[model samples]
Target: MKKDKPKYKQIIDAAIIVIAENGYHQSQVSKIAKQAGVADGTIYLYFKNKEDILISVFEEKMEVFVENLQQIIEIDASASEKLFKMIENHFSVLASDHHLATVTQLELRQSNLALRLRINTILKNYLILLDSILREGIENGEFEQIIDIRLARQMIFGTIDETTTTWVMNEYKYNLVDLTPKVHRLLLNAIKA
Candidate 1:
């Protein structure tokens, strides 16, 4: 399978930088191939086109996202503490890689409806992780008994997402990780019983 080949990862990583620097619409297969140090035709051996490359990048990154998040969720901590760590993890992961952060926070928002929907489907697993935390919180009396899980998941994801997007759009001029505590506190207050 292409996923097992070195060029597959090479192209995916290259596409992140190409897409981030060039914007999704402007980044071409040739540019991605050049960035990956592969021939333009080599790209086709792995992907159908540019759209496939973008979707693949998102899929790979979000898979890691869910894995890291699940590890945090599995830690033996209170629901509130676990939630805090989860928030910290999301911000830290993005803050560690500027190109990845830029592509995820900005370029992802530019995809057409169909592409966005596909990304959303991949994103559902991450949402379920958040849902688990909320359920734990509510069961343990850390969160409001009346809160709706779906709406709460949206709010938490939106707040963290928007906060990071603004940071990316502003050229990451400030400390994104530094904002995590405040965000955690605000989110905690919103859901706390």
Candidate 2:
């Protein structure tokens, strides 16, 4: 019989905390093992190395995030409204998970080039979803026809990423949800038809 996978998840969760708190360079597998309440050898059972864990964390979380966002966007709504909802949901999800946000926004950047490239591949799915929305907006005449779809997608992702990174750096002192409308306005203005 296959061994249970719950322990792997538990280890990954603990690794997020450890990496977020210690930064990637300082986060050791032994530290993650202790945080996860398992032996160091146990982590190897689930992941080949630290890079694997980091990549897995992003892949798993982002898959769920995209899946949920896709469902939310499918509701009856205008493209503009869908865009707004997507931004709101994106920020809200990250804000709700402080540790994950830190790991993703800051610690993850410290990974080596190969790992960063892997993470980028995982991130493209989310970017593609954003791009699709922009395309829809242009099609529906809600977004300006001349706007470069890729640039618009980059701006949206960059703005939200910067905002969240700022919030995380501030120790999350301010309410992130409160910034949704402002971000939405900035994006809408930049892409409006």
Candidate 3:
């Protein structure tokens, strides 16, 4: 697949930086090419246009993100433990990469409706994993059976997403990963049986 090609990875990485630095509307394909160390034409070979590059950037990174979450799911632990780890993992990934954090939390949200839909489709896999954790918690009597799984899922994801967005908006002055414990505890309390 073209994704395995070095240029593809380079372009994706470059696009993240470029998008984060330059708003998606302001980010030009040539700037991305320059950041990727390739000719502008090379970008065309892999992407249909600027929008395609943005989507591809999210796709590549989210694939890895979901994969890591899947690994967390496989660990021999209670659903609460898994949820804590997942929250930690999410915070760690963004905190470790400022450019990626800015791109995902800020830049990605500024897209059109169609683009948002495409991004939402990519996000479903992550949500499905979250749902599994919630279901397991209910089945194992770790979470209150009366809890609405869908609302709980939204709350968990929203809290995580909004926390990261706030950190990003604050220019990352605070240690985001440090909030993991408190965030985990709050979510845990909300769902615990």
Task: Mark the regions of model 1 whose C-alpha exceeds 4 Å error after superposition.
Answer: none
lDDT of 1: 0.94
Stronger candidate by lDDT (1 vs 2): 1
lDDT of 2 by residue, 1-193 (tens): 1125779779888988998898888889999999999999999989888888888888878887799778766888887888888888888888889989999889888888999899889999888888888888899899999999988888999999999999999999999988989999988999999
**In candidate 1, how many Å is residue 188 off?**
0.6
Give model 1's clash tally.
0
Write model 1 residue lDDT over 119-147, tens digit each, in one string: 99999999999999999999999999999
Model 2's alpha-carbon lDDT is 0.87
Name the top lDDT candidate.
Answer: 3
TM-score, model 2 to reference: 0.95
TM-score of 1: 0.98
Ranking by TM-score: 3, 1, 2
Give all TM-scores, in the order shown: 0.98, 0.95, 0.98
78: Cα error in model 3, Å:
0.6
Give the RMSD in angstroms, all C-alphas superposed, for model 1: 0.7
CA-only RMSD, every prediction? 0.7, 1.7, 0.7
Per-residue error for 11 in candidate 3, Å, reads 0.4
- lDDT value, residue 122 of candidate 3: 93
Evaluate candidate 2 by giving its C-alpha RMSD to the native, one decimal: 1.7
